[model samples]
Target: MELLPFDEYVRSLDRKRMSAGVLFRDAEGRVLLVEPSYKAQWEIPGGSVDAGESPWAAASREVREELGIERVFTRLLVIDYVPDDGRMPEGIAFVFDGGLITNAEVAALELTDPEIVSAGLFFLDAVPSLKATLAARLAIALRAAQAGEPLLSENGTELT
Candidate 1:
């Protein structure tokens, strides 16, 4: 029996990019959003999961790297499978709860990463207006928040 070459086998599978992020809310339940210098719209605090990294770990690392804050995630919120768009390869996206934050915690946030321009809180209802993709993802997050359970989604629609 002959086995396929390693490179050939690997190349046969679709490549996807994995990313992880956390959602933080203020006492009023406003969601925390960050303006990425590279993107036209704001995003939540998180980034791509590095090789050999767990989604949870990547989410924590992204928050620390981007916002210069150390916070524990409360629980898994959503796992979304985004299809590949022309501009980006599709992959699984994870959202975890960074838990509630106070005004002091918000003030303590620093944009240490060059990619982050600023961070602010916005009403959950306002998230969809930020960007097309954000609207979809936020929908799932909102459901997760309400149900207090992990949700599976595709692009932004929650899977039953």
Candidate 2:
């Protein structure tokens, strides 16, 4: 048997894409969702984790980059494993607790040009009407938020 260098061995494995998003709420408990110019469906404030970036950091970075607001992630909400759907590779999606933003904070949110079209605060119950995959993830996130524990889900269904 032959062995390759540690770095070489690590590089030989298949890599999955990682994305992080933040779940924001208002005093009325409305979920904050953003409309991305690039996508047909609405999305939360987040993006793909860059190389060597932690998921938590990615969530914070995405919020700043996408919304032009600085938010500190309080805790992890949900971790979703999405299978490849013949278009993109398999991926792990993370939703972080964005904490409640005041009306002033919400008003101050600035959308990134050409990336974010607008932002809206919707009731948690309305999340299911969004994109299928996103709705699934947010459902898990809302549950995790209420329970104060992170959830493990596969495409939105909680894994026992």
Candidate 3:
């Protein structure tokens, strides 16, 4: 039997999509969510990770692009592995801790990206209005952030 060339072997492996998001909270503990112009369900500030971009960089870039604010997130809150749904491919999502933003910072946010229509802080209970998977992911991520520990989840359910 002959082994495939290194490059050929690499290309044969399945490629999974990746996305990174930043979980920002207010002093009152409400999570910041963005309403995308193309989607009815609101989500956190984030988007797909570029091919060559690190998850941290992707999260920071998404925040800056969507909210027009520069924030460096150093702590990762949750890593979720989502299965492929009919609309999207299977992927891994990284949620970073944006800590707490002040009221002034919230007021100063500019929706620089046309894709994002609005931004607001919402209580955890209200996040259920988002896609079910995303809502579960955010709830776990928020808990992980508050607990000062990172969590692992699959399809929005926490892994033991």
Best by lDDT: 3
Q: Per-residue CA lDDT of candidate 2, range 1-160, in tens?
A: 9999999999999899999999988878788988887868888889899999999999988888888877678599999998998998999999999887776777787775678888888875675347777877887888898899999999878887
Clashes of each: 0, 0, 0
The candidates, ranked best first by TM-score, are 3, 2, 1
lDDT of 3: 0.90
Q: Candidate 3 has which clashing residue pairs, if any? A: none
TM-score of each: 0.85, 0.87, 0.92
Residue-by-residue lDDT tens digits, candidate 3, 1-160: 9999999999999999999999998878788999999978899999999999999999999999999878787799999999999989999999999988876777788887999988888887776358888888988998898789999999999997
1-160: candidate 1 lDDT, tens digit per residue? 9889999989897767899989888778788888888978789999999989888889988998999877667599899998888888889999998877777777778787999988888886675337666666766786687789989988888788
What are the runs in model 3 whose C-alpha is more than 4 Å off? Answer: 1-3
Task: Show the lowest summed lDDT stretch of 10 residues, model 2.
Answer: 124-133
Q: Which pairs in model 2 have colliding backbones?
A: none
Model 2, clash count? Answer: 0
Residue-level lDDT for 82 in candidate 2: 88
Ten-residue stretch with the least lDDT total in model 1: 127-136
Provide C-alpha RMSD values for all models, in order: 2.7, 2.3, 1.6
